[model samples]
Target: MPTPSTPLGEFDLIGKYFTRPVQRVALGVGDDCALLQPAPGMQLAVSSDMLVEGRHFLSTVAPERLGHKALAVNLSDLAACGARPLAFTLALSMPRVDERFLEGFSRGLFALAEAHGCELAGGDTTQGPLNICITVFGEVPPGQALLRSGARAGDDVYVSGTVGDARLALEAFRGTVALAGDHFEQARVAMEQPQPRVALGLALRGIASSAIDVSDGLLGDLRHILQRSNVGATLEVDRLPRTAVLAAQPLALQRECTLAGGDDYELVFTAAPAQAEAVQAAARQAATPVTRIGRIEAGSVLVLVDAQGQTVADHFGSFDHFKS
Candidate 1:
């Protein structure tokens, strides 16, 4: 165990906190390279995400939640592709060793990893500004993995869970919006501990035509599918799913938070109208709620509509690393 009295070396810190017995990987920590064996007839799905202090998260966030969020974001990418979690590698950088921080972080990281059967492969730790990078690996059977380029005209657009609450929390943090104590805490949990819809992705394998995780906001992320599939969409802005707190906000604020509020980590997907029942069944099986918010169209233009079928202009762009 790490102690505050003695300076902890990198190898000692890793062994004390990050290293664990291998479950899914052939080789875990303490190796040149971790070995992963995919199931027969399965294709590997991989994704990497880096979180920086002040940019991705606030300085005051608990180390436990930070650890959970770090892994959850990468898992969201796998969920977008209808892939099953297998293993992951973590690269951590911090100014100095904090025993308490490492203990809480590893606890939170391993809890989520064990829940999804994802093993920690191997990684590096170094002294620097606080940053965390994780590369996750998953698997899907051939011809079964979903992609952003599979959407076609006439497909129904759907989103899992809710959106905008994370953005709502962010605005609260920035003092742009004032929320009630309970509401703020609810939104804070949404922001810091997003639930990745992995089971929903697995259930929608054959049912969804295309899918993308809502990390960079719904409209912005959905636009990727649109551009890749060479199609357009008519999104019913009023139909965007959100929590009660977001719903009670002003209409413009609600739209901004739900439409351009990044970090929701929900799955946005498309399917044919004929598969509506199947989509519902899949949602039920996964124990996740999904809302049909739009439909793909032939023209390469995204149109936003209100409840009364009136067209609304989209002014709320999504989060951009360079622009935001």
Candidate 2:
């Protein structure tokens, strides 16, 4: 073979390791620029999110998990919009470089990207507190992107995966929830290494009339759908997804984690009665569990309910950036 070095530099690192795969991009990994050509009759969706140390996450959170979460959260947004993740860019900041940290972080980030067939195109690096920002791009058919505003009265709301695990995991890490051996390890993983529900989101594309991922607490995020769709909702408290560990807590605490605690990143969407079957089938094929938690009504309000269908008092909880 020829000499290994052929003027390859930082750009080469990006192109070789971070570049998007050949599946979706119209262009390759090199050149002065990147060109994208959306598939015929398809619309492109783009989303961006930022996480700062000591703000979005605890400073003590592990670097590998932090890197994974930073990218997963952004991908979650694209999924909610019914988009297939095509590529992404990362912006990382650090006060000082740590080789171990960088290695683990890159491993975590690239692992998810490969699973989803998304590439890390390019991004900027700078000096500062540890902060990771990811911007992702995706594509969906024209006029087919699910949105918060599409829900109508009588549409049923659904959620995928267990809620409150990440929150409970956080609690365990903070020394609040005591666990024995692997239980603690498992919960910590849930809190740190969250998996974005990309497959489920893609599967729900035509099935979900309105969609949003549970980024903010379920209640708060459901409020987003209600406000945008101009509809009211009655969410049954018992119907929400909860892990056994999370449920083992006091009822009030469980409700808090399920309602206001964030980082679930599970897809929450609304479907018409006729679409429920298709929704069920899609989730089954995707191997993700989905639960019907509530229904849409004609107003812009969210009401909580008990198993008896009695209206429960509004908790008004969920992560609010301004408040947090």
Candidate 3:
């Protein structure tokens, strides 16, 4: 129940924009707390992501896209753990309650939630600087959640879809790189509304020994897996998959962005060579194309090598909030 008060008040804003009925949860919005019941023999997978204006995203981005991204990033975490989305909670802070902004934002948010069969349970709203934080709940079968520390020597490394487009778009926006009009729009879409590889993650559940989402740059995120698994990797720099938009850029820029560019919500996973067929079959089932870019090896350092078998020196850096 919402109480009437001043125009665009807190309760009124929630009632008008955020309130919704939930199906998978025991209770949804308008309650003091959201209640959830886990299915038999399944474990809950939860992840949270926060997007701050100017830091995580630009002011020029559309509200709907921001809404989609706010939830998508958190869902990507669930996907990496081979979990199916169950529900989510959104905590939004805005300077004012603008009806038009709320309309677009809610529309984009719920659209993706529905696609994954995730329900909006409950959350809080406040008046402050623009920020969107989403915590997503998912379920994975017991003993089946993919982990980062499971990679083994001789496992093949793979990445889903293309990378670097989002980086290219960001560079374009920063005036550091230039793109043709059509190319700019394509790259912009990649940055604004990255598609989390949820289906592909599910498909790779039993196949991938170690899995992670490429939210940060491929090399950087892959480093996390190597560190966790107590192994290393040799990536073929020329073999990284890139879209036409990124391909049009110079080879130097391509390598720099593909190796260190962040914000692309693709999945990178490793599987044994013997499971190669199963990996391809899973990709086909998920309708997501994956490219093998490297292999796990018996070391603790990541090495980049060219086709000529020479060690490649890359000074490119990946994103870090405090250091970068």
TM-score per candidate, chains pooled: 0.98, 0.90, 0.97
TM-score of 3: 0.97
lDDT of the candidates, in the order given: 0.94, 0.81, 0.90
Q: Candidate 3 on 99-186: residue-level lDDT in tens?
A: 7789889988988988999999999999899989899999999888999999999999999999999889999999999899999999
Report the lDDT of model 3 for residue 33: 98
Better of 1 and 3 by lDDT: 1
Q: How much is 306 displaced in model 2, in angstroms?
A: 1.3
Deviation in Å, model 3, residue 21 alpha carbon? 1.8
Clashing pairs in 3: none
Instruction: For candidate 3, give the lDDT of residue 20.
Output: 77
lDDT by residue (tens digit), candidate 2, 74-188: 9999889989988887877777555567667788888888888887766766668888889899999888898999999999999998888777777776787787767777667
Off by over 4 Å in 2: 1-32
For model 1, the local distance difference test gives 0.94
Candidate 1 residues 248-316, lDDT tens each? 999999999999999999999999999999999999999999999999999899999999999999887
